[model samples]
Target: MLKHSQIWRAIDRLAESKGLSPSGLARRAGLDSTTFNKSKRTTREGKPRWPSTESIAKILQATNTSLAEFTALVEGDGIGRPAPQTLPLIGFAQAGQAGYFDDAGWPVGAGWDEIRTPEVTDPHAYALEVSGDSMQPVYRDGDILVVAPDEAPRRGDRVVVRTMEGEVMVKELLRLSEKRVELKSLNPVHDDRSLAREQVEWIARVLWVSQ
Candidate 1:
């Protein structure tokens, strides 16, 4: 778990890296203008309130940050590392096709630049573009997801899992066992899937989504 202060500091660092004030960052992220205001960090009674997940997502999207990067920024270890390559933003429907991204996950074009992101402790952090409506309501057709490979899988956690056959999907982990894992979609119109453990090549918990 992350402390509230750490989260706030990360937000501040992100703004600083971008040469903007906290309120400026909030505006860029499409959130309330007061989102990162120091006065809003705590209540008049001296209680603390953390930024909402939605707000964080907005900030990540506006800043081109991955979940891994944000986690590092919150921890306060250090900064000034090279930024992540700005990848192509594609819709989920295009995911099944070939040649969109390289094997290393870099977008296949010169139209890329680096964006400041918090450091991520999890070694397995990766980003994926949403593909289909099977994950609607919770995830739209074009949302970007950041998965944490080092995080333990648990019920109720959103995850990015790939089958041994090379198909990858994003969904919520509902149940897990030695034999199989059950995944449910956020959209009620989609039914759940249960896949045998042997069929999975990799599974990672989703830490954040930039919609």
Candidate 2:
């Protein structure tokens, strides 16, 4: 039997996968903004209130998702259930320090915090909290950036590059070649840099950011 909490969690996950809040999802489904609000999950008398099939159908349509995909969500296989997806989170300042990441630019060792995020394709993806104003305008301090080490960054994509010398930077890719790569800093105050491909320990693509 389907539990109330499980179904509600599946809705929550559906919203997250589309990068929308619960209220956003409800609005997109042509319902009241508070339809899926946590407070509405139960009645005034504290009895659990379940989402109607009609509402679920509306949401699935709004998200351009199929019933099978929604069912997979309910089963915790597509995106959301009760349990959360955990990712290693580290501050940008601390990330520059040694021992936090392996030579391949994947998170390793200790001094790392865990954050629960929605399902992503890359199992090795990690989160980095912006600390300084170096990446302002586009990304501010306190923003969370999700990096996928296994994803190769294409030209014009934002990426995080770590050097063999322990220098870590977030920049936009201008050009890449067999021997070197050109990078443009997000902040105009910072000058663009070019590094030999050999000098870079690893370059990971920034998949998502929470402002």
Candidate 3:
């Protein structure tokens, strides 16, 4: 049985191996920065607390890591690292334009740049370079956002959503249904959106951010 301490320790070790702080790893996983904070591990009464499986799954997907690999880190004190992978990359402005991606949202044609990352399990993994300071403190200019087009977008996952009209944006998924989708804006100044399913061209889960 995995103890609470072992689970939390594994998270810390995983963050180090990924070159991130605990908060940074949480952000990469599309979760609140404080999700992995030490303070969050236990109740005010000091009873043992465990990390949620959902949180673990998000981090694993964000880092392109498998459960078995994470288990090894837990059992082996965080030894071993996966090899780097090169992926297609493009600027956000370019992403909105046609010819950069196919109908299914896979990178297509040419003019795509490349970025080397670590262990992205999705073969359709790609990177979108943040364009300007518009997104502000959350996503800055030149930040590389790695995305997995084939990955299913779940509530609370930050996602790249493209509209049928050709607009593209990154927002946290609030709700998903057959008729429509709800999105929470990363920037507080921006209003949340509720778009009909027909209006969405494609949705891709954000797996990581290389800042």
Using all chains and alpha carbons, the TM-scores for the candidates as numbered come to: 0.48, 0.60, 0.61
| Per-residue alpha-carbon lDDT of candidate 2 for residues 14-68, written as tens digits (9 for 90 to 100) | 8878998778999999999989875466453334678899999999999999998
Instruction: Tell me the tens digit of each residue's lDDT in model 1 across 121-154.
Output: 4322445677657787888776777655435556
Candidate 3 lDDT over residue span 28-67, tens digit each: 9999998987546645333446788999999999999888
lDDT of each candidate versus the true structure: 0.65, 0.81, 0.80
Clash totals for all candidate models: 6, 0, 0
User: Between the candidate structures 1 and 2, which one is better when assessed by lDDT?
Assistant: 2
126, model 2: CA deviation in Å?
0.3
The residue ranges of model 3 lying beyond 4 angstroms of the native Cα positions read: 1-84
The alpha-carbon deviation from the true structure for residue 139 of candidate 1, after best TM-score superposition, in angstroms, is 0.9
Q: What local lDDT does model 2 show for residue 208?
A: 90
